[model samples]
Target: MFLTNTLIVLATVAGMEAFAWLAHKYVMHGWGWGWHASHHAPRSGWFEANDLYALVFAALAIVLIALGTSGRWPLQWIGAGMTLYGALYFVAHDGLVHQRWPWRWVPRSGYLKRLYQAHRLHHAVHGREGCVSFGFLWAPSPTRLRAQLQAAQAQRRAQPRQAPPQRPPQADTRGR
Candidate 1:
């Protein structure tokens, strides 16, 4: 029973990547930008409004553990899964990509580099719109991402240049 529960929890944790991708694209970069925008903008302090989301998720895990411990449900395993996923997210998203922590060991041409490149592409867009690669665990090839960014840059350049409006030469009053 314990092993079964562990597997179930692990599956849920893995499945969370899909949920996370949707939430990041629709919620975090959407309406939730009110808080999440702090992440994209230059930092002013150690903490950010974006950190609130992590705190909220942590609180939820605590709640699940509390219930599971009380024998209310089999939520303990689920809670554990969430905790572990959070730790992994911190290491991958924060430590490896953002350099939030001091652990330094830059990867060269492998899954780690791919993940780093994908996330960098996600941030290529200055704002929330036009960003891609929302899934942290499942990243597209870095070559593809680079091509996409370059294509976008080219498209921007292709847009018609707007010439300044010429002043409708001085009216007839001047001629009169």
Candidate 2:
């Protein structure tokens, strides 16, 4: 039972990375931008509007935990996994990367460096549309992220802009 619960927690944590990537790419960047836009801009106070997402996820975890405590199996573990993921996200995304916390140590090398670089590249775009590196815990190589960003920018540039409709010339009916 212990091992099974532990495995569930581990799997859930891993699964969250993939889920977060998809949500970050589609929801956060798409229709949900009204809330997520705060993250892209300079934060005015200690909290940004984007923090609502954390609250939503935290509420979900709380509910799952409550259900589990009420007798449902595995839910507690899943909730624990989510809580753990949130903590990790806080440390990596908010603390290490964004310097939201007092500790401002930049990663000198290794996976931390890659993670740092990938997220930085994500913000390389001006708006929400062209960003890359959506995942929080997992990040691709910096080179690959850079190439993808460049390709997306080039694609945008290659597309022709539509000209405004022109008014057709009318006959001189007033003279008649």
Per-residue alpha-carbon lDDT of model 2 for 73-120, expressed as tens digits? 889999999999999999999999999996689999999999999999
Worst 10 residues of 1 by lDDT: 167-176
CA deviation > 4 Å runs, candidate 2: 164-176
In model 1, residue pairs whose N, Cα or C atoms come closer than 3 Å (at least 3 residues apart or on different chains), thus clashing, are none
The candidate scoring highest on TM-score is 2
Q: What TM-score would every model get versus the actual structure?
A: 0.82, 0.92
**Model 2 clash pairs?**
none
- lDDT (C-alpha, whole model) for all candidates: 0.83, 0.94
